[model samples]
Target: MNVLVIGASRGIGLELVRQYLDAGQRVIATARDADGLARLKDVGAQTIQLDVADPASVSGLSWLLDGEKLDLALYVAGVFSTGGAISPPTQQDFDVMMHTNVLGVMQALPQVAPWVEEAGGQFAFLSSDMGHIGDSRSSRGWLYKVSKAALNMAVVAAQPDYPRAQFLLLHPGWVQTDMGTSAAALTVQDSVSALRQTLAKHKSSKTIHGCDDVPYLQWDGRPFAGW
Candidate 1:
């Protein structure tokens, strides 16, 4: 299978590229810069320079793909920031998070979705459980949560436009990564492994759970309630 992993320079994106390549799949990974890309290339992935926040860069991916059909395309680009009630998020923080997490997905989907649809493949956005309004309790990471909530909406709105492809919003659990930190509940390997298994199970399935009217889903392939 042919796979496309966006924001693959590090963390979950990087792991996804590695695992896909290990499975003998043709993987194309992208990052904003060349940092960490050499490692991905070393692992048998074709690396591309892409910045989802930049429209020109996203549009360039279309030409780079050369109309090659993609079996799976995953958008894993996002940003997070933590601030308590005493110290709220700054304007810069909001802008960076929203641009990368929300607008970036909105812009890239149009360019990448068609490629997946052409091959009857799957397209997914890496969202977070914090985005689930029904599961909300704490006020921490408000900015990050709001950005992902917007991303969920974007995914749902775009689904109807691409009837042939499966659109999923996956929550990769609380992974122990740079963003998730050491205190996170799950390790990156376990999280990615479970997500890969879920992807494998749904590879040929026409229905996308939780995507009929909403786009909230867990990494274990279960739908989020009250979404």
Candidate 2:
């Protein structure tokens, strides 16, 4: 299968690339810097230099993957910030977080979704339960929460346009990554394993629910309701 992993430098993204490669799938991965590219290369993935937060960089994506039909596409790039309503985020923090977490995905959607659609594939975005509006209790890292919520909306909004691709918003749980920190609940391995399992079980049977049925799921396949 052909898979595309966007923002595959480290953490969940990197682990995804590693697992897929070990499974003997053809994988194309993107990283923003030399170190990241080197790491992906070391793990045997086709590497592309892409900074999703930059429009100019994202604009070249379709060209990069031309003629390729992707069986799966994972948008796993994001930024995290710590702040609450009381500790208002600075303009810089807001811009960086929103640009990376929300705007980057928006820019990448049009570029990557077509390839996934061509293959009747799955397009999954890495989101967080912290983004769940109805389920949210704490305001800590509220800005980050707002960014992920916007990301969820972006994926849902784009789903209808890519009818053959299953658009999924996945919460990888409290993963033990740099973003999640060491104290988080799940290790990167366990989180990504369940996520891969979830993807394997999903197929582009749009007829079952049509394009409007974008699924918001956890790493474990449990559906998350109430946006």
Instruction: Rate residue 117 of model 1 by lDDT.
Output: 86
TM-score, cand. 2 vs. native:
0.97
Residue 194 error, candidate 1, Å: 0.3
TM-scores for all candidates?
0.93, 0.97
- Clash number for every model? 0, 0
Off by over 4 Å in 1: 84-88, 204-215
Regions of candidate 2 where Cα sits further than 4 Å from its true position = 207-212
Error of 1 at 181 (Å): 1.1
Per-residue lDDT tens digits for candidate 2, residues 146-172, read: 999999888887787777888888999
Best by lDDT: 2
Candidate 2 — what's its lDDT?
0.90
